[model samples]
Every structure is written in structure tokens, then in C-alpha cells.
Target: MSVPELETLLVADREQVRWITLNRPDRLNAISPAMLDELESVLTASADDPSVRVLVITGAGRAFCAGADLSPGPGDPDALPDVDLARSDAVFELLERQPQPVVAAVNGMACAGGLELLLCCDVVLAAAGVPIGDMHANAGLLPGAGGTYRLPRRVGLNPAMWLLLTGRTAPAEDFLRWGLVHRVVAAGELTAAAEELAKLLSGKSPLGLRRMKELVRDGLAQDRRTGLAHALAVAQAHQKSADYAEGVRAFAARRTPRFTGR
Candidate 1:
């Protein structure tokens, strides 16, 4: 559902997919401080809602996101007293930990914080020829919102360094080859393509997807053996779920399974 007060975001729910569009086309949908708070709020809500099986994060207009707004807005955390330093990065971390699988619909240019946003999501479907980069160096700023850590882990050290160092943009094709973007479609087809993917994900069992997401995200931090152990543990627990039983029954019955997210 759309929140009228959200100045920088346009949120809507179509079926089980929650589309969170960064609005501020005039500003190229830059991540202002207000935008970060709104994003955190929306993401938190989506994570809590059982009906929201998938999330598609995109931007309005020609650009996905141009990165952080250089001009500080009113009530900036840095300008406030007794500010929680950890709060700054918590928004980015929340996206990473969010249970729903996120699909980033990268359109136009996604740079700096935009790239950081992509790294948090599970998969990225970018518009063909869309350029993405970590251009913080050009702006005399370092990526403070989990970009440096997530970027390298996602695209390898050399490729990550190339973007972080050069402050130059590469076509979406480059990112797809680098294992960052999942797929690329034409600019006009981006929204429809993203919606198609979201709907595809929405048809699956929510509980199953959430647990699988947890496995992949958690396993990434552990050794192969430890990760395998964790996966087995998760699988053992999941076997007792109603969704699992329904899945088995539906397979035997040769029908589409109905999952209630249990």
C-alpha cells in the first residue's frame, strides 16, 4: 500500500510482491537522510508482513539511484545530539537480514549508495546498458553503508576494487558477468520483467524461501563444513513444517501446492 507521507518513496503491493520505488526523480532518486529512514521503515514492515512474499526495490524515472544526497537535510543524525553512530549503517544491515528475498530492479545509473543497495538484495534485474558503479572516490567520500564489505564479497576483490578505485560506471552487462546483476532487460521492459520475477517468486512457499534465504546468507559467513551442518539443521527443522508436508502432498497429487507461510 502507498504511504502518502513518504515523500521519497512510492510503495505499492501487487499480489504478494511489495514494490518499493525510490521517488525523487528530480534528484535522480538520491538517498537523502529522509529516504534512508523511509526505506528502513518500509523494509521493516515488509519483513514483518507474511503476505509480502517478495520485494522489488527500484527507482522512479530515468535513474535508479544516484547515491547519497550531498546536501544534508533537516534533522540529520550527524547534526543531532546524542546520535547513535550505529544507526547510520543499521538500515543497510536490515536489508541484508530481511527475510523476504529482495529483487533489485536497477534502471539507468546506480552508483555509490545505489551499488550498496544492489549488494543487499538477493538478485538484481537491471535494465540493459544501465551503468552501475561505486563512485564514492570521485565525490571524496568512502562508502559507509556496507558497500566496501558487501561489494568485494559479491563481485570479488579485483572487480570491486576496479569500481571503487576508478569511480567510473560500467554497463549492466559487466555487472552480470561479474556476478552482481542476475539479468538485464531493455529499459522499457525493466518494470514488467521485474514484476514477472516477483510474481514467480510469490508463487513459492514463503516459509521455504525465508529459510532458504537464511541458509544462503548465513552460510556465506561460515566454512563449508559448518555451513553444511547449518543447512542440515535448518532442513531437519523445516521438514516438520506444514509447507513442507503440503509440498510433498502436492507433488504426489500433481497439483500446485498452497502455502500459508507456516
Candidate 2:
């Protein structure tokens, strides 16, 4: 189930980080069916491996992702297109469900489904001057991927509605103001910034980070009492882990801990 190197998406692992790059710079890194399938398979592979602690997704060149590849329109132009929107969503869900942290380094124009993809990331870093638009409405369409749902949750109801309804393009400043992007950096500094953050996060106990992501994501849907209860349970469980004991010992000795991800 490994992805062929020539596909529109490319995945590589370094240290504990799995770097995923959109390779179709010629088409603005548009996602094709093979690309979508490869993305899912690669994500699953990373999730299953304990050595992977973080996943960084970015584009090859100018654009992060221009959206789906509607060019060939799913093999045949005459037949009804079997566009698998579900497959796209499965990728999104994989991002949400993955135990490791996922960071999206938005290099350039992230519009339509591209913006949706950004929303799926736990943290999004955008390059300066990069513009993002939700062009579904302008093209007489709507977000099929988790855009309508995740966009509102990230940016708020009013702003999300306006963007989706008007299909307006937002600059990097606007994205920062709307809280869509976690950080914004100069164009050339994009990779460095994201890598710095990734390095910092990767230094932590892997299980702690995974549980934190799970708690926040799953706890949001519960009542306050239930959420707190779940948090306590998670804390108790972690306290019993080997990494937690090492963390305490390292703290008392005033030294950095080498976490084995127990």
C-alpha cells in the first residue's frame, strides 16, 4: 500500500517526523484519485508505527493544494463521475484520529478544498502573502470535505459563513486574525518555522501528546463534568506510564528526559 514516487503526493520520514508533500506543482498541487488514496494509505502507515511522532504536510512548490483534480473528471468525460468525496473525508478523519501531531505548512494559495485541508491540521502555519479562498459558492458548489463543519468550528460561525457564502479570498493577516492559522511567517522562513515548532513538539513524551490531542478532540463533545472526568482519567493513566516516571525523575535532577514513548 505504499505510494509510488511519481504520484501527486509524496511522503518521507525523517527522525520521527513524516513529511508529506503535494507533488503536483504543475497543476498547483491539485489532488487526484491516486493522490487521495496514497495520502490515506501513508497516514495509516504512519499511525501504525510507534517511531513516528509528528506528521508535517506541505506542498512542493507555490501552492499547498489547489483542490481536487477535475481535469480528467474521473477517467471518462461522458459518464457520471464517480468522484469519491468520502475518500477525501476519510483522509480528513485520519488526520483527526491519528495519535501523533499533524502540522500543515501552507506555502501558498490554499483555496476551496485546500482551506478545508488546512482546517484538518492540528496546527497550521501559513507563509506571508499566501491567500486563501473558499470558492465553492462562487462556482455554484459547496464544501464536500469537512469544510462546512470544521471551518465554522475553527474560525467561528459568522466568519465561516461569510467566507463560504461570498467565496472571498483572505490574506495571511486575515487568516491570523480569524485564528485559522496558528502562526504566520515570511515566505522563505515557512519551512524553518514549521520545523522549529515540530522539533519542540517532538521532544515531548509521545504518548502525552497523543493523549492530549485525543482528550481535546473527544472531550469537546461531552459535558463539562464528563470532560473533566475524562481528563482526570487520562491524567491518572499517564501518571502510571513509564515516561511519566522518567519525566518526574528528570525534573528532580534538573535534566532533560529522554522519553522512550512508553
Candidate 3:
């Protein structure tokens, strides 16, 4: 299938996985307001398309994203008028609410707002040696995009505080210990590894994936009892899905299940 034409992004579909590349190599794939708009449009389309089962977001050239584009061209139509919490929150919410799983393939430098963007992904895989950090403190600023909350949830309170306070960039491998990164691969293998993971996830039942993602994300803010209750409710509801039946029959038949994502 032909991929959609986009100026700030290069998108492609393979084996039901949609790969969205941040394509601003000169700026190290910095997030301009135009890029944010393009991302929202692409993600909205992917969410509505039944063929798209998973999403892998990465950057072009040497960096994943160097943060927001503070300097935009005069002709840039999608440039944000200002950097504010509401705008940042909206973008992050768009990312988090997508039904399909979103994976961040952090290929290189991910700092400041870039790191905040990565936090929105369901899974994060980073290239070894790539630097990652919360750099807002360096600029005498704070994380405006779910970073303050998401960072602590991902890496724990103390680690999040250290990163945010120091404004120091650490190698990607360092974050694996903190659970900020799911996997760290050699720089050359980053794309392939991310693709492999995305394909693996895409083959599963779509309903199951979406529900599980929702449960985990929502459960984070709830008490243990409340979270368990939510999980049980989802499990009960999923029993009525066609994919659930196929999964059970396939297990009994010793065969691979064909999930229609129902």
C-alpha cells in the first residue's frame, strides 16, 4: 500500500505495523508545531484504520528528537504560538489515547521535550550509547508535557527527581536498569529490533492489546483493589469477543490463532 504523503514525517506500513519517522534530520528530528500536527493527523488515521495494528515512532538521522523547535520559519503554518502546558498536554494525550500500541524507537539523543514525547509510548526501545534525559532544568524550565508525572511512574520517584534536577544526559543503556527503556540495542540494530518487537505485538489480538494497555495505564492511578476490579471487568468483557474464542480453540488445537482483531 502507498504510504501517506507528509512533510515532517515518513510513514510506512509493513505486516500491520505502522512506522512513523520524525523526518527533520537537519534539526535532529526536532518537534516543530508542524510536526505535532502531522503526528496527530497520522495517528488519527492509523487509529481509524483496521489494518494498522501497531505503531512504531522513531526519528531520522542522528537523533530521536532534540526537543521542540524554538525557532520556526516565518512560513511555518503549524508552529505553536507559545510553549504552554495545555498545548503539550494535548499532544501527549493524543499519543496516550491511541487505541493501537505506540512504541518509541529512541535511536539517538532524546532530551527535554523529546524525552517527554517518549514517555507517551507504551514501550520504549533505545539505541545503545544514545543520550537520554530531562533537560528542562538546564533551561531554567520544567517539564510541561506529562514528563513530571510520567517520569516518576516509569523510573521511580528518586530517579526521576535526579534526572529532572541534574538536567544531565545519560547513555540509553543506563536507563534500562531504571526500567525507562525496555530494550537497548546496538545503534545499527535499533530499527530492526523495534520492527521485530512491533510485529510480535501486532500478531496478537488487537482487542486484548488495547484493553490491556488501557488497564495498565489507568491502573497506575488507582488503588490496588480498584485496579484489580478494573482488570476483572475487562477480562469479563473480553470473553464475548471473537478473538477470545479463536484464542481458546487455537490453544486446544495446538495451532496458531488467527485473530481478526474483533
- Span of 10 residues, lowest total lDDT, candidate 2: 1-10
Candidate 3 local accuracy as lDDT? 0.88
Q: Which ranges in model 3 have alpha carbons more than 4 Å from their true place?
A: 1-5, 72-81
Error of 1 at 21 (Å): 0.5
TM per candidate comes to 0.93, 0.94, 0.93
TM-score of structure candidate 1 = 0.93
lDDT of 3 at 195: 83
In candidate 1, the residue pairs with backbone N, CA or C atoms under 3 Å apart (3 or more residues apart, or in different chains) clash, namely: none
lDDT of 2 by residue, 1-262 (tens): 2445546677777887888998999989877778888787888888878888899999998899888765755457767444578888888788778889999999999998788888888999999889997888986877888999899899999989989999998887788888988889999999899889888888899989988999999887999999999999999999999999999999999999989889
* Candidates arranged by TM-score, highest first: 2, 3, 1
lDDT of 2: 0.86
* Residue lDDT tens for model 3, 1-262: 3335689999888879999999999988877777877887887888888899999999999899988776644788677445556776797789988999999999889998899998899899998889999988997887888899889988999989999999999898878999989999998898889988988998899989989889988898899999999999999999999999999999999999999989
Off-target runs (Cα >4 Å) in candidate 1 are 1-4, 72-88
Error of 1 at 169 (Å): 0.8
